[model samples]
Target: MKQGRSLLASGFVAFLLLSLAHSTLRIEPERSDASPTISDPAALLALQTRYRSLTRQLTQLTPSRPYIVVDTARNHLFIKRRDRIMLDAIASTGSGTILDKPGETAGQWIFDTPRGEFSVQSKLVNPVWVRPDWAFVEEGLAVPISQADRVEPGVLGAYALGFGKGYFIHGTLYPRLLGKNVTHGCIRLNDDDLKSVYQLARVGTPIMIF
Candidate 1:
């Protein structure tokens, strides 16, 4: 009887050891659901090259006739004709000042030379400056109610090339302020430069300000 009990206990121990070994030594199946990731350096470079080519094709400006290019930050203006530069002169652009109005109907004005493509809509000799509301407000004066009060003569020098929205490339009485950012929102040049530009730049001529 004693021998049989001992043999039974030995068999139980062997069974437990085998069960523990089987539980610990598991072999999970390899994960086949994950997608593979691959990177090609040449493919990335080819995409970048295509994007640059498209951008260059889009931004290339090929003017057939005379065009004006204004460099506002440098206070310079250049008139170009095909491949030749017709006129290059010092200029005065916007002052970039801000005026704040505080009230229910209050608004603000940013005196900046707008950057984009524009065209000469009109030309005037001895152009009168019909001062806007901001002009009066800037000087700390009351805005006039009558139209006659806004008509200030002989301020826009000898010539004016009107782009839209009351902006102009015109002559300045303040010739000393040339090559400086001093205008309210116009391009100011010396009398000689203004005369040349006014005569050369026709209506519908392209003007690019940067």
Candidate 2:
């Protein structure tokens, strides 16, 4: 909505292209006055049949329940119920930075946000961030042997929605960094947006990232 375009419209266009790939006729974006029309009634009928089938598939694929859509490229997150968008907020996603592992010769991590479909697996209030090894390494601090040394408080806003494998949609201390790709891998939202998300989402709420 920030861009004044529905992300679902892109999906529909993609679906239409995929559906047309299997058909004999092609739909061109621009045409001259002499553009050929389907003179054969049978071919026109086949095209109509494919249209109906594709429409049905798209309708069936629409989610009935509320879901999250993260547009990592645009740095925006949306909460949508079917065709209606419930919330659209500026967010910070993965930075795509490469950090070398301290001990391993070739080991490194590319901190790009994970894509594809995922669901909210856990939600926490007043979340505590147990800082990982990368955090210490990035800061050039010595890695602590004790786990207690890793417990960090207050930096990760008030709420966190975990989507498994150490990734979360959480609050950020630097709300000014919203709309930028500057996170380790988690999605960072402002406090107000995060609170709304935490209240709206559930344990199994679907999160679609792209």
Candidate 3:
């Protein structure tokens, strides 16, 4: 009978340890200081159109070009034109946490996407993930994981759109996983839609998430 009690205590202790171990995690890597130089006309045109549409939908005001509307609470993005919504698709948000502010930390902790006004600062194609050291130490994980581990698979590698300081609207490997607040701090989107967004948006495009 005593042995049985001991085993139960051991199991409980193990569970707590496991939970603590998983409290912190690293999804990908950090952004670099390099600026993207796009040279494709077709890609540039698409980005312009998308930006025009999204901007129109969000404000219900017509802009001469296309734009994007990101509503974190609704888990949807609207590509609009004039006063009409051209495209409406599911989007995965920041894990329900507010990390856009400076001096904040990153981890596996789940939270909702933050609501605020922001803008697309830049676009990156085949960009490298520069992992943060704080995430490593907090999670009891190693800082600066290997390049192999940093390279996430799927369309995410194809295009990554930066917004504000550290926030981004990027592609995801799991499109079906949209409509949920499940990203570390970035917004996740479908591959096709992301490609379209990538082509239409440019640096300085306004993004309002609420």
Candidate 4:
């Protein structure tokens, strides 16, 4: 319901902006001796009223608690509460590389990290990486026939926060690559930063990525 309202407010805001511009474009001299001025005061007043309504809608939609923001373009993660930033850490995001899907069909998987809002669905300690078929394919190895072969340990470091799908904000073994696009799709931070995030964020904490 909130998302629907947000969309509606956004559309309304756009419409008002366009209407305002159109109104401005339509402005002409009421008299040859007069300076240029607003042609329709009533329409402008209505737009201002709608703008106030939209402002309220936007204010109500703002997050009230601590949230996570991962800037994929800049490789930065911020843990923020309201207007204050609690933590700022260098991070690594998806590589945007593609891997050809194995088989006769023409298919491929892009490694770009997903964008938009998500919430922490789960948390983990001493997380284990269950390798996927892509991992094997990327390494030029055949997909393991047994499911047990996919299970790998000690790769995700001591802490992880799952934010839906298979994506996570987790610690990395290669701390040197903290500020680069190197992961498959997950957000990677150093051990210290990961620990701080793990401790501060709880299940259902909102995460915004772009």
Highest lDDT model number: 2
The alpha-carbon deviation from the true structure for residue 56 of candidate 4, after best TM-score superposition, in angstroms, is 7.8
| Model 3: per-residue Cα lDDT over 32-85, one tens digit each | 975454478887676566655544443433343455667777789876544456
**Could you estimate the TM-score for every candidate?**
0.70, 0.77, 0.57, 0.73
Best-matching candidate per TM-score: 2
**Candidate 2 per-residue lDDT over residues 46-66, each given as its tens digit:** 888877776666556555667
Candidate 1, 42-156: lDDT as tens digits: 7656655655654443224335467788889999999876447899999999999898863567778888999876778899998998899888888889989999999999888
Ranking 1 against 3 by lDDT, winner: 1
Q: Candidate 2, 167: how far from true, in Å?
A: 0.1
Number of the candidate with higher TM-score, 1 or 2: 2
Each candidate: how many clashes? 0, 0, 27, 0
The list of candidate 1 runs beyond 4 A from truth reads 1-61
lDDT of each: 0.77, 0.82, 0.62, 0.81
Which portions of model 2 miss their true places by more than 4 Å? 1-53
Judge candidate 4 against the unseen true structure and give its global Cα lDDT, from 0 to 1.
Answer: 0.81
